[model samples]
Target: MEGNLAAVLADRADTYGWRDRPLFHSGAATYSHGEVHDAGARAAGVLRSVGVRPGHRVLIALPDSIAFVAALLGTLRLGAVAVLTGPELSGREHAYVLGDADPRAVVCGPGLVPRFTSVPVLTGDDLADEPASLPDPVPVPAGAAAYVQYTSGTTGDPKGAVHRHTDPAAYHEAMALGALGMVPGDVSFSLSKACYPYGLGATVFFPMFCGGASVLWPDAPTVRGAVEQARRHRPTLLFTVPTWYARLVSGPEPRAVREAFASLRAAASAGEPLLPSLGDRIEEVLGCPVLDGLGSTEVGHTFVSNTVTRRRRGALGVVLDPYEIAVRGEGGVGYEGRPGEDRAAAAAANAAGLGAGGQAAARIGERGALYVRGPSVMIEYLGKPGRTADALGPDGWLRTGDLVHVDEDGFVHHHGRILDQVTVSGERVLPLEVERILGQHPGVVEVAVIADADADGAGEEAGGGALAAFVVADEVAPPVPVLAEELIGLARERLPEHKVPRSVTFMAELPRTSTGKVRRSALGRAELSRNGDGSLR
Candidate 1:
C-alpha cells in the first residue's frame, strides 16, 4: 500500500503465482503477467530517460493495446501521474487537455507525435528499444496523486478528477472482490476502452487483483466483434453499457449471439439506466444474471453495484459496504437513517396528501438528490478548486447531482440528473422517465427526450417549453412518419399528458459519449421544425 499503483502487478504475481499466465490478449498476440511487468519496467526506464519525474504528469493517448497498458503502468512505476485520454479525441479537445494538464511527457503512437510539438513526445517505438529488465520501482506515499481522469464533458467542459495511489486498491476491494466475486481463471472482457474508469477497472485493476486475464480490442468494439471475441476467448464476465446491451439483443442473430455468450457467467451494465425490459432480454438470451450499477469518473470506479447473489433488474443494487448513500432533498434534507426504512410509513404519509414537512419526508423515499461519501471518491478536480468545492460537500459527502430514490429493500432507483430535470407546464419532468416509457415500444430501439423551447412565443401560454423525443427505430421498423404517430399514441396511453412528447424525430442512432451515455446537451440544440399538425418536420 505504500508503493505506487504499479506494484499490483508484482503483488499479484507473488500471491497468485501467475508469472507465465496470460494477462492481456489483443488479436492474435498475448502477453503474460511477467512479460507485461517487464515491459512496464522497461517503459519506465524509457520515460525516465526522457526526464519524467515523480509528481510530473505523463499524458497517455494510445489505442487499447499492450503498449497503452505498459505506458500507464510505467508512468505509475516512476511515481508520475498518468493522464489517460482516448486516442479518438478531436484535435481541439486534445489541445485543451494538453494545455490544462501541462504534462511533462507524452506517451503515444508515432502518428500522434506531431500533435505534441511543445511537450516531450515518446512514441511506442521508443519503448520497444529499451532493455527488458525490471527497473527499480519508485516508492511513493499511499496518498500520493496517481492519475488524472477527465470527465466525459457531456454537460460542460471536461474536468480532470485526481485520484490517489491507494484509490485503485480500494476500488479493487470494493468492486472486484466484494461485488464481482472475481477469482483466478475467470477471463474478463469489457467493451469500454482503457482510458475510462469503467474500462480501467475491468481491463486493468480487476483482472490484476483477481489473477484473471482481460481481452483488449485495438479497434472500437462492435456488436459482431463483441460476440466473436466472446466465442473465441470464452470469458466468464463481460462489462459494457446499456446501449450496447440493447443493440446486441436486437442484433440480426439473437440465437447465435446468445450461444456466443454461453461462456459468460455474469454481465454488468452501467453508464445509463438499464431498462427492466432490456435486462430481462439480456438475462434470457445470455442465460445469466445482468447486474446493473452506477459509477462515475470522480469515484474512480463503481461504489454501488448489484451482486450475482442478490440481483435487481432495474434498480442499482445496495450501496457497497463501507460506502454510505443518503437521499437528500433539493434543500439538503436527507433520510433520517439507513435507506431501507419502513415503506409502510412512507406510503401512508404520502397517501394522506400531507402538508409541507410530511411531503418532504415522503419525497425522500421517492426521489431526491443523491449524496455519497467513501474512501474511493476523488480528492479533488485538478486545477478547478471552485468546481471541486461545489461537488464535494462538508464532511467528505460528494453531492452527486443525481436524482434518485431508495426503496424499502435498500435498492436505489435512478430518476435522472438534477440538471436534466426540465419544467413543462409548471411541472418538473425527468427525461429518463419519458425515455423509459418510450423504450418499451417495439419499433423504438433507442430514445432520448429533451425540453425544447416552444416556437411562435407559445411558451407562456401552454408551458415553459415543449417536449421532443429523438428516437432510433428498429432495422425493420416502419417509415419515420408512421412510427412517430405510433410512438405518440403509445406515450399517450402510458404517460401523463405533460410527459407525452409533443414531437418526434428519427435518427439513425442517438449521439453518445465514448462511454455510451446519450449526449442530451447536444440533443437540446438539435434543429427541428414543427409541422402544421405539431409533429416533427
Candidate 2:
C-alpha cells in the first residue's frame, strides 16, 4: 500500500464508525474523530496554499492540542515531512532548530508567530476557520519520510530522527496492541508532549489506532492540574515519565488524586527507569499497575516493556516481538567502564543468574551495550551524516548508547548512560546508581548525581574527582546542611563508599531538557556549582 498516516487514521475512523467518538478533549472542548479528520483536510488546504509540497520539511512548534494533531496529519496528507519541536523552547533554541531544519514553512502557536518571519507561518487559528476542503490523498510509498522527531538534547545539541510513514502504526502494534491490548473504550492522558515519541505513541498513535480519545492540555501540567484533568476526562491509560509519577504519589495520596486515577487500568513510565519504590507508591495510590518501558526517539517508541501480564519489578521488561535487542561488548562484557572494571559488573550479573540471546550459560550474566533493530527505527538523522554514522551502522543496528544487563528471565536492567560513568577514586561509579540511592531519601524530591572537579584536591574529599548531588526539595523540615547530610548518610548506608556522592548541593529544580531528562552536564556548572562552604561557585 502507498500509505499515508492521515489516510490510515481517517480510514480507521470511517471503517469503525468512530466518527461520533471523541478523538481529542482539549480544555472545555471536545473534538470528534470526524471533526478532526475534516480539520486535517482543511489544514492540508492551508499548507498547500502556502506552497508546502511533498518531501519538503514543515517545522511544527505547537502545544499539545487538536490543532497540533490536525497540523501533523495535514502535513502527512500533503506528503510533506513534519518536523516537531516544543513551542515552549527558548528563542535561541528555536533559532538553532530553524538553522538546522531550514524548513519550507512553520506551523506554530499564537505565541510563536513572531519568531518565524523567515518562513511561511500558519497557526491553529488559520486551520480552525478554513472551510472544510479535502484534498486528493497523496500517494507515497510507505517508506517515504513522514516526520522528524528530535532527540531530547540532554547531553548536547539535539538531532532530528527521521521516521517513515509506516513507523507510527508499527509503534501502535508493538506497544499498544502487543504490550497492553488497547481498546476503543480506553482514553489516553499523557504528560509528555507531541514533540516526543513517548507522548506520540501514548496520546496520538496508541489511542487513535484503537479509537480512543486523547486528553490534550496546551500547558505543561502541574500535579494539581493533571489530577483535575484526569478527574474531568476519566482517562484509562496514563503515560508519563518517572519523575512525574514520583510527584504524583508524594505527600498525602489525596482522595481526589485516587479518584482521578480510579478509572485507569494501567500507567506506563519511560524516559528513565522507574524506581521500584516510586512504582509501588504509584500503584498503591492509583490502584493500578505501573509498567516500566524503555525506548528512544530513533526507535519511534518502546521496543521493550513490562506489561500487566508479565512484569519484572525494577527491570525494563522483555523485548517486544517487533524488535531485536542485543547486548554487545568485548568478550561478552560491558564496554562502558575503565579497563577491566566492568568485570565486576559482569560478576554481579553472573551472581544474579545471567544469559544472553539463548547463548551458552558460560557467557551468563553478561553486561554490555544495547543494540536495537526494529521496523520503526529511524533511517537517519535529518542532515548530519557524521552524527548518523556514529550512532547507526550500515547493517541497520542502532547503537543505543545505553548499558544493560540481561537476566535469564529476559528482563533488561538499565545501568545508566555509558558516558555518565564517573571515576571516583579507582572505582567507576555510575551517577545513576548514586542518584537512585539518594532518591529514596524523604527530604529529597529529585536528585541528579554528576562527577565534579575542583581546584583543591577535588574539594579535599574524593581524592582526584568527586561525585556531586543536585537535589530539589520543597517541604523539608531540616536545613539545607542537615538535609544534605541526611541524604549523604542514606546513600552511604545503601551504596558502597566509592559509589556514594562526595558533596551535595541544593537546587530549586534540576535543569531539564524539553523531554524532562536531567541535564547532567549542566548540573555542576554556572550558579549550580557549589563551594566547600555550600555557596554557589
RMSD of each: 3.6, 5.0
- Per-residue alpha-carbon lDDT of model 2 for 329-368, expressed as tens digits? 7544332221113455655555544435333333434667
lDDT of each: 0.81, 0.81
Clashing pairs in 2: 334-367, 354-365
What is residue 401's positional error in candidate 1, in angstroms? 1.4
Q: Per model, state how many residue pairs clash.
A: 0, 2
State in Å the error of residue 335, model 1. Answer: 3.0
* Least well predicted 10-residue stretch by lDDT in candidate 2: 332-341
Tens digits of lDDT, candidate 1, 1-537: 556778866776877799788888888888888888888888898998888899999999988888898898899999999999988888898898999999999988788888988999988768766653456878897678999999989878999999988888777877777778988788899999889999999998788777789998878778889988888888899899988887888777889988998989999888888877778878888888999998889998887788878777778886775577767764444442333446566555444544234444444356777878887789899899999999997688788878888766677889988888887877888999988888887777778898876433224345557688888777777777788888889899998888888888777677899778898877766475556443455
Q: Which residues of candidate 2, in runs, are more than 4 Å off?
A: 131-133, 332-362, 455-463, 474-479, 529-537
Clashes of 2: 2
Q: Highest lDDT: which candidate?
A: 1
Error of 2 at 259 (Å): 2.1
